[model samples]
Target: MPTARPRLLYVTDLAYPARGRRYGDEDVFLTSRLRAEFDLALCHPGDAVSLMDAFDAVVVRNSGPVLTYPEAYAAFRERAAERGTPVFNPLTGRGDMAGKGYLTDLTAAGYPVIPTVDRAADLHRLPETGRYVVKPRLGADSAGLRTVTPDALRAVLAEGAATGADLLAQPHVDFVHEISFCFVDDAFQYALYAPRPDRRWELAPYRPTLADLAFARRFIDWNALPYGVQRVDACRTPDGGLLLVELEDLNPYLSLDALDDGTREAFVTAFTASLRRFLAV
Candidate 1:
């Protein structure tokens, strides 16, 4: 008899319409490849809590913003924690998975992150810039993101965390380019960049310098997930340096189609290995 493969509950929303990315195609391509090594099953994010128990582990990928279904996501988290289910990103992510609040935390800790302030009273902490970015503390994919003058920003801040409206404010960054470092667990897989800041989805392979690797690895080390996929996004400042833009740990859309066949295969191989390790734990 053949050895039984681990059963995996792959959570995704194939119908999600991402602005600059194709969430469906990437998940489709990945699950097709993943089928070779695991007894894989796909389900929407809303259904994960109900069906996850039968699987060895749950692999959350491109399930769309949790904001769309916060209650379901919360329930999933609660159930997973209750059962100590091994989630791929390991529910321990402190980055975007948990919320954008980490931006404020990272800034305070003096990580090379964009200065983020959660309180309106703390507006003075931000740099004197032409404009400021105001977005929901739990925002994802630029949802509810906006810009305003310092005066307008103050008024919004004065409203004061009314109910669930607490916002994150930052000096609008005029960066040269945006880049992302993809990693599996703690191992750096590859880098990609968008030359034009406006064209975020038009990505190209980026060859990272030693310094670049050092910067990206700082956050990966900080996140400390033993097994999972992560992407450290950063932007090139006007002074020719990179600052942490975001650390995406939960269901980050891997632009697999952007990579060459070899690179894609390498990622899949690494992912397969990582999943096996996670299941064993």
Candidate 2:
């Protein structure tokens, strides 16, 4: 007799109205393909905690921003950890999965990231720019992100300090383009870029150079998640250098629609294999 296929609880917010991208379509496409090898059931982020135990593994994909349901997300993480349930993107991710605090940490460590400061006292560390970007430490999908003049930024930082709100400030970077390197378990898969900064989701396939791959790999290596997918987001500065913008380790959108049929099929193949490996562990 054949063995039963692995059961997977795939979490997603199908109706999530994400700007410039169809969250539902991407997940629908992914789940449809994933069902081929696994016994999969789709559920919303809010339902993951209750349903996770019944499945062999939980695959969080396009679940939307956790900020929308912080308590539920926190509970899911806590419960999953306590039970030692296998969660794809393994709860061990240190990038966006944890928070934006890594930005400041990376900056302080001399990584090629946009200089970030979480406290008003560290404002002098940033380069003098006409404007600065202020974002909440736990922000995702541009939530609580703001651009302000230097004085306003300083005032805001001071206010945040007084209120004890976690915030990070950085000099606004004037970059030529934004690029993302997609990877599956430390292996580079593919890359995509938004040529027009104003239209962030209008993505085009980008062929990464050796240097670009090295730049992205540095962050992936730092994150050090032994399993799960990651997308290393970066911006190309005016001087033609890549700087880390965001490292998404939690439910990073694959933008599968942006890839041609062959590439998309390849990604699906890789993703399915990764899931099998994750469950075997």
Candidate 3:
């Protein structure tokens, strides 16, 4: 169904200033590698709806947080869905791609996620910890997040819930390490971890054991996305177990530069292949 080379509209914000991540550099590197197999054109997320029609597929990469341009992003999604355009991370992702509401659902369902509750009535569900992490259910990149003690949570919830602003409150997790598993279309590519909990971006290659793989795979399989990339972010608890922190099925920042050459190449190959297959459908 494709010609000698497929055409891709790669969506990214080349100038987005992420706190500790180089969104542009990673996209430059990825598009460079991808160009070898496909005819690619880069565009900011805002322009995707305008430019997407000409390409065989639209590859939505590090386009920054949707909160940056919520209305434009909504328009892009509406147009794509209306036209049945092929988006790489198929618009059906149920994790962060959808919203953080899954955290509350998963918490109620007894998943190993950090306990989350939104309503004032649900406040009692959370563990009694010194402080709690309260964040917008539709938030990204830590926007509008606050750390509050139990005494103040009630007042915050009263205001937050009244505006239909779904909120998530979780006890501050004391973890040994934060690790992430990267996957392309349900296949695990590699794992990385931040040894120093304080330095979230200072990562190193992590070789996941069978148990680790099993833990990550469960969430991936649960997501059941036949295409698109997903990142399973977890933290090693003090009790020597992994707890799901977030399922990043949205614009996950791939730290490819941190990986070894071989690993990086492998991921690129897998990603390119997955994109090809996804576009074909």
Candidate 4:
């Protein structure tokens, strides 16, 4: 008798209209490759809770911003956790998976991150800038993100406090460009950067230095997930130092299209191996 291959429930929102990236294209490519290894099925975020039980593991990829389906996402998470299901990137992630609260935590811990504060009283801790960014703690895809003068920031905080909403404030850094370091199971995979900040999705291959890897590694270590992929996003300041922008441990867009054929193939190989190991555990 032949052995049955592991089944994987691949969750994605193929129709999600992302600003610069094509969530559907990426997932379509990924699922095509993943199918070679596992018996895979695609479903939207709204259906994950009901379908995940039929699979051996769940691979959450390009599911789009959870803010759109907050109740469904919450229910999916709760069910996955309660059933002890193996979720890629594991639901235990402390980075973007949990919320933006980690920014304040990393800031307080002296990590090289954009200075962040979550309260009116703590605003003093941030440097004086012409503009500050105010964003919801649970925001994604630039949702609820705005740049405002200090006065406007204070007002926003006051309103948030009144509504009991969690928000984070950060100084508007004048960075030259933004870069992201991708990893699979604690291993560095590749790096990409946007030379023009205005066009964030125009990515090019980036060759990371020892320092860059070290910087990205800190957050990966901090997250401490024994398995799963992660993307450490950072900005290059005028001073040539990198500061953490976002540590994406949950369903980060791989930007596979930006990569060369060889590089894209390598990523698929690494991703497949990672998934295999994850299932064996």
Candidate 5:
């Protein structure tokens, strides 16, 4: 039912005011490139539910955290399901899109993920650390994350329990650096890393080894997304092994500017091809 050039409803918040990054600039660049292949219109996350039905598919990017507009997001999801509206990230993601619960599941299953537990009673499962990172299960973009002492960890979890809010706790990892593997439709596109964990947005291009690719690929295969972008974030341990920090399956930032010209062009080409393939289905 699509015309010569299919219509795409590109969802984004151009002025999200995030920390250490310009979400608007990145999205403007992406949309400019994407316009070459499709008739695209960008809309705010709050407007997508009302405007999406007219477009062939909706591409969510730079929309910021769901907590900012929970009601709008829930309505969007509900309407999309009722009408079977095509979403690029496909709503069946089992990773962060669902919640942080997958981290605990992966930990229990013996994956290389940093050990995580949702309930206070499960604290014994996590390694002993002077400080633990306690975060809300449904949080994103470090919205409800905190680093606290052991006593504070229990107090916070208990307080969350009293209020019927879900939380997860993990040991603070002492890693040499944080690396991210970017992918498009289950295929590896490129990789980047930050030497100093304190400066998360200051990234440099990384040449991944076979073992490194294997480590990242395992999580990609586990997620098994039909189509869309994914970023597998991991930390390099002192002993030269990687641990899964998080699996970002929904609207993961591509960080295209950090890449060289050739690599950036290749990524855009692959992303366009992947979108075409996704639309075909």
Candidate 6:
């Protein structure tokens, strides 16, 4: 007798109008591939909490920014935890899955990240630059991100303080280009980069050097998720060193379309194997 495949409730927002990215196309391609190994059902993120209990695990991908549906996301997290339903990325994620506060944690730990602070008094910790970036600690996809002068940032923080809003501030780094390291489980898969600084989604295949892989691995080591996918985004400083931009552990938009057929297939295989391993545990 053949073994039964795991049932996976895949959560995504296919209609989300992501700037310079195709959330629908990527998720479509991925779920199509994933269907070979699992009984997969795709649903809008809003419906995940209701649908997930019937499946063996929930694979959250391209669900859009939680800022758009904070309450729904919160409920989903709560329900999943209460029922002990296996989540693909798992709730233990410490990076973007949790929130941008990880940036402040990394900064304080002296990780190679753009210095981030959330309070008015902590502003002095960041180096003085022409401008600083003020963004919500829970923000994603550049939502609620802005550049401002130091004085303006202080005012923003002051307002946040008054309103009790979660916010973070960081020095604007003059970086040469942005790159991302994609991984399945803890193993590296592929890398992509934006050659043009202005175009964040205009990605091209990047060949990582041993040094580059080492730098990206630092965050992977930090998060230490036993399974699931991750993307380590970083920028090249003028001094030829890398500073982390973000570590996306939850539903990272894998530029599968950008990869060659072989590479894309390899990612699917790795992802499938990871899911099986995750199920075993």
Per-candidate clashes come to 0, 0, 0, 0, 0, 0
Better model by TM-score: candidate 1 vs candidate 2: 2
lDDT of 6 by residue, 1-281 (tens): 11388888999999999998899999999888888888889999899988888888899999998889988899999999998988989879999988999999999999999999989999889998889998988898788899999779999999988998889999999989999999998899999999989998899999999999999999999999988899999999999999999999988999888898989899889988898888777
Best by lDDT: 4
CA shift of 223, model 4, Å: 0.4
Tens-digit per-residue lDDT, 90-181, candidate 3: 88888998889888888888888889988888888988989989999889888989999889998898888788777888889899999999
lDDT of each: 0.90, 0.92, 0.90, 0.92, 0.91, 0.91
> What TM-score does candidate 1 reach?
0.97
User: TM per model?
Assistant: 0.97, 0.97, 0.97, 0.97, 0.97, 0.96
**Reference-based lDDT, residue 148, model 3:** 94
Model 1 C-alpha RMSD vs. true structure (Å) is: 1.7
- In model 4, how large is the Cα lDDT of residue 110? 97
Q: Model 4, residue 241: displacement in angstroms?
A: 0.3
Write down the lDDT that model 6 would get.
0.91
Assess the local accuracy of residue 57 in candidate 3 as a C-alpha lDDT between 0 and 100.
Answer: 78
Question: What tens-digit string does per-residue lDDT give for candidate 5 at 158-253?
Answer: 889999788899999999999999999888999999988899989999999999999999999999998999999999999999999889887787
In candidate 5, which residue ranges exceed 4 Å CA deviation? Answer: none
Which stretches of model 1 miss by more than 4 angstroms? 1-3
Residues 1-281, model 1: lDDT tens digits: 11278888999999998988988899889989889998889999999999998877888999999999999999999999998787888888999998999999999999999899999778888999999999988898898899999889988776647665878999999999999999998888999999999999899999999999999999999988888999999999999899999999998888887898888899999998998777876
